[model samples]
Target: MNSDPDRQVPFLSYGFRPFFLFAGLYAVLAIAAWTGWLALHDMPGVWITPTFAGPPQQWHAHEMIFGFGMAVVSGFMLTAVPSWTGARRIAGTPLLLLALLWLAGRAAIWFSAFLPPIVVAIADLAHLPVLAVMVLGGLMVRPAPRNLVFFVFLALLTVANVMIHAEWWDFTSDTASPALDAAVLLLALMVAIIGGRVVPAFTRNVLVMRGPSTALPRSFAWLDRVSLASLAILAGLAAAQIEGPPTALVAGVAAAGHLGRLSFWRGMATGGAPILWSLHLAYLFLGLGLAALALAHATGMLAVSAALHLLAIGAIGGMTLAMMTRAALGHTGRPLRVVRPIAGAYALVALAALVRALGVDLLPGHYMAVIYVAGILWVAGFGIFSAVYAPILVGPPLPKNPPSA
Candidate 1:
């Protein structure tokens, strides 16, 4: 552990420690409480009395993307962008303030049903889009060629968020779904973009493992560019769903492009490391989510609602879970060994995603049962991560320069 708090207090220095710590803690408590809200709705002492008026479906949709998913995005962006641009880390007072913004937003959303709807509109929708501004603002001032596009992503996310808020405010129902889709796709794109860069880099650094050698795939940077173009075209079509065959075409291509991007990352040799496998598997959800949607849309029989949870629970939720776990451990200066509980935690989350996806369809009568188990598993997964990592944050960090993976 660094004896000097001053040193670690710098944003990049503490890296994923603080955000990951708080995020994991919040994940367990927040999602569990939310799950409880779904089943046992009359608990008064619960977090601010569930107020957002909807069936559990839409509420869960909003919270998981806006709630659990947003927190992970905050942690990763605050921690990583500074390092990417050689800018000073957003730590001490500013970092803490940003975290408060997140917490306040959560509070506002929790009591949203009770409060006026507009209040929920301003508070819940405001944070991350603003976060996009803050993060990109730093990066834009002193640009890194490799990273500037991410800033575009951060900004586009804000636009999607505004559309989401607009939908909630009774502007239109169609906008919300597309906005939600864009946000998840953007996150997956970020994961694919960033993960492609970091995962193998981290793996090689840790295990001294070489990249897989099966006539290794092309970088396909052009595909990334085209994917963004496809998303933009789809987003426009989404704006007017009734007007365009091009909309369907774009979505189909975008989904396939993401799958190809995943393939190029050379996704093996990850099985040996917990951090590595978790990331690789989470990314697989990205491809799966997109493909599922593409196929769902192509077949007239498929519903849009059925395709979304694939990205929500599986891609977005899983990617966040894997990243928070790995980033927490790595940035904390801890060794890369997995404890048994943590291993079980990983397994539980994967199971949760599967149960939510497959179980819901196959056993309509038992959907709640699947969800209940998923909620339990999700809570347990983060609970374990938080417990193990809490001491690492509140106290001095673990010793620097620990052994490799």
Candidate 2:
């Protein structure tokens, strides 16, 4: 829109622009496809056979975590590393290529029935390492110990992904399920780590600006360290397929630690701010979800699927949407406040998580109905995001000094 000859194409100008857009759209479409395939699977005369590398459920899990989840992670890392280290941003051709690599992985997985397993594995596995190299380049510019740990996260994620693909390649028969669990835990850990840093910082900034604040967010405290450490241990146990009392103990400790850590943040005081409260709510889910997971392991009161949906849909989905909306706004030079529709989108996702996680358990007779409701809510939330943010992301940034009102 600016028509400046020297400006990069607006969508390719920053990592967040295209990748966030893709993440939003893919979140909607992928879930929709999964739900549709599921609903039509038993219907007579239905012609909806979708071929995937694995079972439909595995394909759903894989794409949501590896495909959709990684896109958001990639976008955030690519955008943040430059900011954190004063390095040049990955943009233009390199960024475009990176985006295409992610898309290719999705395509190869969706149509893997027609493709060689080796080809599918290679195509899918290539994106993360290239992303790691790009992120490492920027981290090397400054190289703080705190920042460099993310490279390790990327490496672990790659290993988890490989574990999943190994099953497809006949390297192992039973690794995919546990590996998927590991991947989810790793992503949750990232959310916990990043959320710990930003949620309080942003909340404090808003609180201070609004008025003098008696209580501000307490971060990087003893409890925070305990929380992260416990979650990391849980992730390790998951990767190794450990079960029973030990995993339950760690998960329970992690749950208490995170919830306790959250209480120090003063989330309730951020009244009427969707951008702020959505984050708090997502963190709340992270804590509660872990608690549920611990219960699932220790007592036979909850289904594992319910606990996982709480983590995957509630914490991961809600946090990513909140961060994506907030980041897209700030980086694009738009106001940091969220519009009403986006606010409703936040509520929709939270409700979707609750319904998906607990609905069937509550009303066992309506299992399929509950699934349909949850999927629709999930789709609608991201549909709103994609529609609202498309123009903002693709358009040139607002002029720093606009014409006087």
Candidate 3:
């Protein structure tokens, strides 16, 4: 096997190279389309007609979670697994084929009306399992015990996706919401697992690189295990749609466990660096969102959708953007620094989370307006990231040795 990857064409040489760009582009276009549909679909002379299977709301949520979120995950895993397990990375033909699978899923969902429901579901559902095979198979070669839990989450996610499609195909009744809820919680668990590792490490790296003698984060074994177990239990209960005092109790306990887990991470020291701070903030949103979810189950004072948005836009969206930016720069051999526009991009996404999660609840009279504003902010933030990173993603990787060197 050739050790040197063909870098003449950068996009196909590495997993993160193309998938990050595609995920960012899709985030912008999907949200814009969803917003247009929401604001104008019922108007007398709307120009763009949105056509798809299932209710518009479900379609939007499905695309955001299963479509955009999965793309980011695929990119990250493809690149990160090599580092974790010392296995050969997926590149060249294999990488391109995986990307095509993802693209095909997106297109099948968009034009689902023209195809049979089962066909559409099959097309959209094939990517994740293949992704799992690639990741777990690679890990099997090296056998990392700690990272093995990701396979369990991936399995649960695939089951949720199947339930979602089952509801759409009329094989089941009202399964989509609980399935989506389950999927969201599973992703949050991944965020917890990944974020717990990366956040403290990144913070420690920055401080050490800058010659600071700060006390780094300490990991608590009991808290870590408890948090993961609680989240897994929550995902199962959510999928079963078991609500009432028991559900509320589990949610509350899970929330507290996660909060305790985060407190051990040195989030306060990450303030000066946007790249590091964004991740801490995103993880913070996860804890807060889970707490709000507990409140929703207990008192019914807040809409479940609000809590969902907090996890969706805040945790998933924020963390993906932060990771993409950092990974793109690091893989390209550039300095670990955030540009001004990218910093602004991070802020815009955070603002989107705030407005979507809280603004709609506080100002009921202007619900649509709030959504439109949040959509615009979300789109613009991702659009900015796409534009800024396109050159790096498509062009040759940054030269290892500059002419000056």
Candidate 4:
């Protein structure tokens, strides 16, 4: 790979370089603070400002989705789209500008009460639009021969944020609060779409690099269409008020489809592959989360509370950490291995999901404890990745400079 040409290069000479590092590090600190304050009742609900919705839930959802989650997406897109299109890397001041905008949004939401609602709203909605511009800009400069239209999903994510902002500003009805749910579903849809391409491709790349004898399974035919269609329909249903029966039916089918798709990835076989397992475990949460939500509605046995946690904490949080860590390592010219502590981070997340899903009723008041643990594990995982990979994201190039030859 060619060296980055920017003059203001620090440790942030690449997109994933700084954003992934800061994002991952922030993942630990933000969630820990969030979980602790919530658990200990140390922080007031009004600690954050208002916009579309109350700061309480807004703070939580925004950080998880756009803060931690969007950071991961930004890192991946900035890193990958350049490679895909042969475009110049986004680095130095421009990258910092984007990161600061994200941080500003987090701060505005955190102290939203002190600031005008419009101020918070502007800062909050700024990151994704900036990101969409950055990504779509790549297409304009040097369009990827085939993946030009992929920006549609990134654009859709931006649209989802518009709905989210509508709720923040009371432009929508009282039911507008559910726009958060719509945003979550939209995030899930993006994960399914992009994760579908990258994880398998990366795994296959690693296997090929190592040797043909170690090739991961390659059957990706039905999964692409089925998961996409299911999520698209689900996204629409999530936005509108659909009847219970149709909702239940779609949820059940999505769960099954996700699970069936995941099975082909051979997660069990990839236990030794930290990069692979991180991706697999994240995907597992997606499948299990869909199933958990479906079963919740179908039987009325579990509340959406547990299911949402499963998706947010488990699927979204877990996968973002996993993918960001993996991509950061690879693109930064580091080995693909997750250090022991980082791997332990994954274990902590798995335990968190189990505790959150199974323990809410079993150990009801301990939600804070589970959340605290989850936040700690989650943050620690990303924190570890930041420590290890920040150096690699900058720097010149790999020592040996070997491609998958």
Candidate 5:
């Protein structure tokens, strides 16, 4: 339970260090690779074969959700659970092993075309169960219902992942797309749940420190409950592959509930702080994405892929980067302020989401161009994060006190 940083090998000292650092790097690398794949796929005489198993598009989708997304989730959960349960932190050797397992999964997926499908599946599937067990053990110490719910989230994510691999194993051809949808929804739910807790709380902390403030962000209320419940329902429907009016209805309700929930958080008041406003922006995407999704199903105006991109690029990407920056800084005993590059990174990611989600519709004549631009923005955003935060993550924490100024 000690809060002190382990100095011998700072990178392996805690879960957040290695996971967050690598997640940022992988975000840049993966997106760049995906972009490259897209650009070269159609060119004459350009025989760019994929290094990853499966189709390029499938690899892109899978890695973003399970690879990049899960890495951030792992980092956050591993770092936070100890504080939540007052249990021993997973540091040193155990942390390294867990991180290595995640890296191995990425490698297995990348080279899956050459490897045995069963071996690839086993390697890629191993990380989540181990992570779930580690998290469950910690939650069991305190056993609060609220905290224990995350264990359920982890378990569901594992199931969703298996569904994706089922196609590779030739068990089912139709499962991967729906399973990926379910996975995205699950991640969006995590964002909703976690952001619900932190955004308003962090905003209120900043507001309180600033001076007297009568209108504080609201606490967990009926709207929050409704938002989460509706989203959970939609996620279940996606997993079940239920389509038509029912899915649209639930998505509409979820959209309304989430946007309504956000209104109570007083996001407008946090405009002065990039660290806080970035979160608010990310939550906004969650609501907007659901709305787009509902419209896509109901009116057939928007592509479902477009809507999911909003959730993927904006909600998941934005929120994770925002949280990673804040946590990395705070845990390293540095200021909570976002430097200019990191703040620009935040803006680039939001812009990337907007472009990716809406650009084709807005500029129907230039579909490939839109994709390329969005990919560039995504790479730049996370590239900045990886470059800027690498030292902070790998280096020792700042001293608590120093000689007099």
Candidate 6:
């Protein structure tokens, strides 16, 4: 490692460094805990208390979305926003404080049963607003309109989180579901936004490095507008609980638009690289999940929960894993390539998504068995990831620039 006096502590030097590690570990541990709760909640002597004072299902959903999901989002935004807005990277004390706030929230929620409800609410809901402020601070430096758009979404997500806690505190009724649904849709929108930029750009870079010039991914401005607008409309309707054929039709349109949009991204070119292929597969899940969601609401042939899991476990989970691994390697001064074990990790998560999203219905008689298998695979995948990448995330970042591939 370079011994420059300017080099800060490894873990606190960059936002991605610590947050990625935490997210990976949380992904594994949270799922393992959730699985245990699901399997043994009814057992007479099981004392696995998450300290959630609300419905266990609500606790699980909230943790996955605001917990695991936001950590990855924080890591990504803190790293990527600087690149986007030409601002200095957040580091040192500020980053550490931000990370600590996140950890505090997780801990508060875990021990909520013992804490006063107001204290739990304050502790749990504090991270996102602070994150929004950090992000806005960066975006304000140069004020890129495109990048600044996320500030609005982040604020909205904060509201959604608070709304869920509101329901937990009996400040509202049946609001958690809609709030979570909105949060999920917002995350899907994020996948669309970030995935649109990175997938094709990364693919283009890889293809360029491999051979003679290849066709760059196509972009259609009009379709991009339509897709985003339709998604926003769908999210609004869902949050508002405006159930009708009209909302379903809007969702269906959005799904089709997203699917068609993904088709033009040249995902096929990414097949050779696990890093690239994983993202493509994850984006495919986003499209399929939207379609399934539309079908569920429109025709009732599929379960809404099932449809959402494709986005959750498949898209959000898959994409975050792919990004975490790729970013960890690249930022740590390593080759942007996956080894056998990492490749296996990707396959396990994909399998987990399939099992969790579909197998519950396919083998209804063996639902718990399917869930157990999915949980095991989910834990194994993230376990391998956290084990492999922990050192890289904690070590000094690379001094040299990586090759395009």
Which is superior by lDDT, 5 or 6?
5
lDDT of each: 0.67, 0.91, 0.86, 0.72, 0.91, 0.86
Q: Write the per-residue lDDT of candidate 3 for residues 161-216, one digit (tens) a residue.
A: 99999999999999999999888888888888898889888887877766656777
Off by over 4 Å in 2: 1-6, 45-47
For model 3, what is the alpha-carbon lDDT of residue 271?
82
CA RMSD, predictions in order: 4.6, 2.2, 2.1, 4.1, 1.9, 3.1
TM-score of each: 0.83, 0.97, 0.95, 0.87, 0.97, 0.94
Which segments of model 1 are wrong by more than 4 Å?
A: 1-15, 41-49, 53-56, 171-174, 204-218, 226-248, 300-302, 401-405
Report the lDDT tens digits of candidate 2 across residue range 76-181.
Answer: 9999999999888888888888999999999999999889999999999999999999999999999998899899999999998998899988899999989999
The regions of model 5 sitting more than 4 angstroms off are 1-8
* Consecutive 10-residue window with the lowest summed lDDT within model 4: 44-53
* Candidate 1 lDDT, 177-210, residue by residue in tens: 7676666666666766676676656655644445
- Weakest 10 consecutive residues of candidate 3 by summed lDDT: 1-10
Which of the numbered candidates is closest to the native, going by highest lDDT? Answer: 2
lDDT at position 218, candidate 1: 44
Cα RMSD of predicted structure 4? 4.1
For candidate 6, list the clashing residue pairs, or say none: none
Better of 2 and 3 by lDDT: 2
Number of clashing residue pairs, candidate 3: 0
